[model samples]
Target: MMILVFERVIVSLDLENGLYQEFSHPLYDYEPANRITLGVLRDCLCTFSSSEKFSDVWIMKEYGNVESWTKLLCVPQMGGCGCYIYTKPLYISEDDQVLTYFFKMGKFSLAVYDSIHDTLKIPAIQNNIHDLVPEAYLPEIYFESLISHFSQD
Candidate 1:
């Protein structure tokens, strides 16, 4: 089982050997609200975050080795405005280099990060994304349940 010590830091337990190893960023002093997303892209372990001055995408070149961790990309927040926000990885391009992601502070539009070119492109009007808001499939309203489903008379 995998246990996430902090929001960004991941720790794994070896059941057979009863050994524990750090699988993510060593530093633990970060805001609890700050979120880091982990995924497997291009067959490599990757994590993305926008909690710092710049958005950083970290990739573990050789798994289980902290030294092998590398910052794949460090994107300046809001083009260097310094407003930190979360950026979630959506998918990897067919070439396995370009990464498509979504910025938590953006206008609900998809942004493509070309790691090879070290560039970011957001297709707003071209992609027909305007005033897009993330929400659940079903609209929800807070209310009290009048009956219990588990009670047997």
Candidate 2:
């Protein structure tokens, strides 16, 4: 299984045989302020998010191969808009064209990352969300809305 340790290091493990191995880690000097999230797509496809203005989406083509970590796409932070501090890949489109994510910037928002066009789209939500306060994971101060729950399945 894939594991993200200390929120910055990614590792793989074998629970049954009590085996584990080091895998990958971020190369940049990280601050707790930035949102860095990891997720597993359908069929154990792995993805990583570099939650920033010029954000990066990384995918693991080969499950346990560190060399297979590929950059799926780069999402430019919209003009003066809040960055996605938290993100989760919901599902890939049936046609394999669009990817939907439960992304949070200042408030919980939805981002549809289209692979065919290499673009990110935020869908309109019907709820009246409150203005969100930012919270940074980096040592420096920053602000954004916080998400409380996520499903394991």
Candidate 3:
């Protein structure tokens, strides 16, 4: 059985070159059960589930590398790379407990590092991402929160 399940959320960058992609989820570690065994689907993207969410949902969009600085129309991005819309589902414990071990920002892009798999998942906005892999800043990520959102079926 597949342990991990994912959902896709989106962020749009208002830019010249508009493009987008859908983020992919891992094969394991996102199921409802007791004592989930951590498994690696790729060299990156890990966890008991990709179920960490703490943001306002929005439409997904893309932007260009260079922005109109003189006109002050576009805001500068961190990586300047286009990103994919992702919906990540989390694991609600049998005891009605929600565990969120990811990142979140007010309006800025959210990025995280999977220590178990050793990779960084950065949501790009420019259009230079060759492939999604764990990044060098993977060690800076931490567990966000653990709340209550479970069911006993």
- List residue ranges in candidate 1 displaced over 4 A: 1-8, 13-21, 26-33, 79-84, 92-98, 103-107, 115-119, 124-133, 137-153
- Candidate 3 lDDT, 1-153, residue by residue in tens: 779654532233323457553333223223323322232111222333222221111111212111210110111122223322222313222332222223223122344433344333554546322224423222222343221235457
What range of 10 consecutive residues in model 3 has the weakest lDDT sum? 68-77
Candidate lDDT (C-alpha), each: 0.55, 0.51, 0.28
On lDDT, the candidate that comes out on top is 1
Root-mean-square deviation per candidate: 12.4, 10.6, 21.3
For candidate 2, the TM-score is 0.55
Tens-place lDDT digits, model 2, residues 1-153: 998656445655665557876767434333424466666544444444544455555666766677777765555555444534435455556544434444354455556666677666776655334233333221111222121245477
33-140: candidate 1 lDDT, tens digit per residue:
556666665556677665555566677777777787777665555554222354566556665344344444543445666666766666555425345444322112
Query: Alpha-carbon error at 58 in model 1, in Å?
Result: 0.9
Give the clashing pairs for model 1: none
The global Cα lDDT (0 to 1) of model 3 is 0.28
Query: Which candidate order results from sorting by TM-score in descending order?
Result: 2, 1, 3
Alpha-carbon TM-score of each model against the true structure = 0.53, 0.55, 0.17
By lDDT, the better pick of 2 and 3 is 2
